[model samples]
Target: MNSMKALSVIFIFFLSLVTFSSGDLIEDVCGTSSDFKVCIDALRADPKRCSTDKKGLVRILLQQCSTKANSIYNEVASLLEQAKEHVLIQCLQICKENYDNAIDDATSAIKYFDANDFLAARTSTVAIASAPDTCEETFNEPPVRISPIKSKDDDFMNFIGLTMRDLIEDVCRTSSDFKVCIDALRADPKSSSADKKGLVHILLQQCLAKAKSIYNEIVSLLEQAKEHVLIQCLQVCKENYDSSIDDAETAIKDFDANDFPGAMSAVSDVVSAPDTCEETFNESVKISPIKSKDDDFMNFINLTASLINQFGN
Candidate 1:
């Protein structure tokens, strides 16, 4: 019985040593971050998942970012609904959009991380780091200054930025794709934009380019389709794409002029074009003989529609 008790004590001692060693390693890894305290606190809050490696640290940070983004999105959405001042409403709308984009970007970062594409993950993470700043910048203009909102967002963004900078520095020091990853993140339009309006401009430009590409592809596909029903469906799809392009162009004009609501409304129209095209095919009395091709085209159209919808809300 004494020998067994001795063995149990030894086991407990070794287990404590292992736990202390893990905590020390976590501290060392977090010590390299810009906000070591924040990093340590965050990681310690979920010690089971926070391993001692750099990748583990990044994963935790990304998870935190995703959670914060979702919370901010909900808060901003609620605030927007309650807002009455025209300028405040516009600012809140922009904030809501930024938070939504941040959530999407963080989700993409997680996906890239899961795939071991650190460069892509870094780019998405960096974009998310800029979201709070982009939202706060909307109130920097004349007669719309909201000090409390700006202050809160600024502090939150600083925390996010510090952690991100630490992650980027670690990646540059350790990853073989250091230069490529850093360069890609630095050039990301979402991360580099100076303000909400600038970000909107970039989004609109990308949307317009994508819309044009989809339009061209559909037209080219329509020319090759030999079946009458397939041709008719493709033609309808082409017409929808054409309308989407026009609406996208109008959205760009609205965005450039800082007419955000107008831009959003126009982009919403662009989102609906694909659905209208698909509905046309669905309403046809005769079932499409080229059912497979019809489904393929419709799927493609839906994807394009979904992409455009992101730009608006």
Candidate 2:
């Protein structure tokens, strides 16, 4: 009986030693991060996450990022209600969107990490790291400065970003596609790091580029159909293209000047111009004795309209 009791005490002591060693390992790992104190505290706060491995440490960091991002998102949303100044309200709105994206990316990182897709996990982590900068960039324009809320939120997000970045660096040290994935994401115009206004600008630019392409296509089609009975229909479509191009250009200018409402109105005009052109073509065909259809031009107009509508939304 005494032997059995002594053996049990020895086993317990061994277990205690293992636990302590695990904790020390976690601290040592976290110490390499930018914010070691915060990292250590977060790891210690969740003892269950101390798996004494790099992957486990990354998971813990991602989980903390998700929690912190969600909290910041909620706080920014709540602040929107009390915002009275137009500039401040706009900044908050942008911040809210950025935090929303950060939360989503963090959640995605956790999912990817669970699946052992370290490349995707690191990509998401990099996006989350940029969210705070994207949010803060809105107030960098002249005559509008960062507010107290912005300062606090920036600090909070920086802390989370630094923590996640350290984990991402660890993952990238072994990930073959880490650099490629990161470069692709950064080059993408729809990067999560882009501010709302920047995204809108990109959308507008796309609209303009598409509109110009369609305009050239319409001109070519009109010339080809000049001797055909569909000449009238082509002419009407050409006129619509002219108007659409003009409206899109105006919208781009308005957007550049920060006149959001005006830009939206111009985009609406661009969207409707194509519809009216298509309608006129259909009506002309219906009245004409020649039962002919140009599916190609119709499809082109339809696609352009669809793209414009999507960007407007």
Candidate 3:
């Protein structure tokens, strides 16, 4: 028994050493200069400040910057937001340069996160990896006209189809505010007309199918959240009204001008819808008075989502 206890003690010591070492690695690589040193040092100075485990590194990094982290995180976020791998890689490199020792880890993360390829896959099956060096491939630039919309590429159509599936699954089935998510897609004026219309038609059909799930929770349990969903939908509708109307108008113009393909593409934009439900569902949780922060927010969301599925039907 004594030998077993001794072995256990040694094992624990080894584990603690590894844990502390990982924390050090995270801290050293996350920041530059003595400023970061101070933040990490605080963990040693006050046991209370440092987490007993190493999962707290991100929290510490955020705490160290406080308000500035928001901007930094935003920059990181925008890379994904606009689906700009080049800019994202630049930002990640900058992050590592600022925190040198973590360069390998950061690089590894960047290498693994093929955001360009991933987002591209979302829209089409041919994983057209974004050539980071291509000067014209920034997020603001139009999506590369890979092929005519009617091209016989099964993968491309599958890509758009899968994305629509996700938008329907993640958003349309969850809340009534799906219109908001669709608005983001519409902002890109260059998307093919058929693709846009097909995407929206899929979502609307899925929502109607899921409407039965939220029948009970629709009227009560989470009215604030319900209203928030409606508000998001209304807001998106308000913003897209002009654009959608314009797309329809443009489609007519293209058709009259005998631009069959262009008219179809234009028509797609006017008809396409994206799911905007998640944002409102999330926001409602933030302002909810009945539930404490620990009150199983995901479960609440699921419940409210069920309600939303039935709301408009």
- What lDDT does each candidate get? 0.58, 0.57, 0.33
Single out the weakest 10-residue window by summed lDDT for candidate 3.
3-12
Q: How many collisions between residues are there in candidate 1?
A: 0
Candidate 3 or 1, higher lDDT: 1
Question: Candidate 2 at residue 213, lDDT?
Answer: 72
The candidate with the higher TM-score, 2 or 3, is: 2
Clashes of 3: 8
Q: What is the lDDT of residue 202 in candidate 2?
A: 54
Instruction: Give lDDT tens digits, candidate 2, residues 1-313.
Output: 1111111111111112223344466665554444456556666677776454555655665666677778777888888988888888888888889889988988887898778676676667657755677667777765576654565555554443333333333333332344533333334424333333443455556666656776676677766664554677667766766887888889888877867667767877776545666677577663422112223333333333333344345
List where candidate 2 sits over 4 angstroms from the true fold.
Answer: 1-23, 31-35, 50-54, 156-313
Give the best candidate by lDDT.
1
Clashing residue pairs in candidate 2, if any?
Answer: none
Candidate 3 off by > 4 Å: 1-229, 274-313
Best TM-score goes to which candidate?
1
The TM-score obtained by model 1 is: 0.44
Give candidate 3's error at residue 57 in angstroms: 90
lDDT of 1 by residue, 89-156 (tens): 88888888887888899899788876777667656765765667777667877765673455546545
C-alpha root-mean-square deviation, candidate 3: 21.7
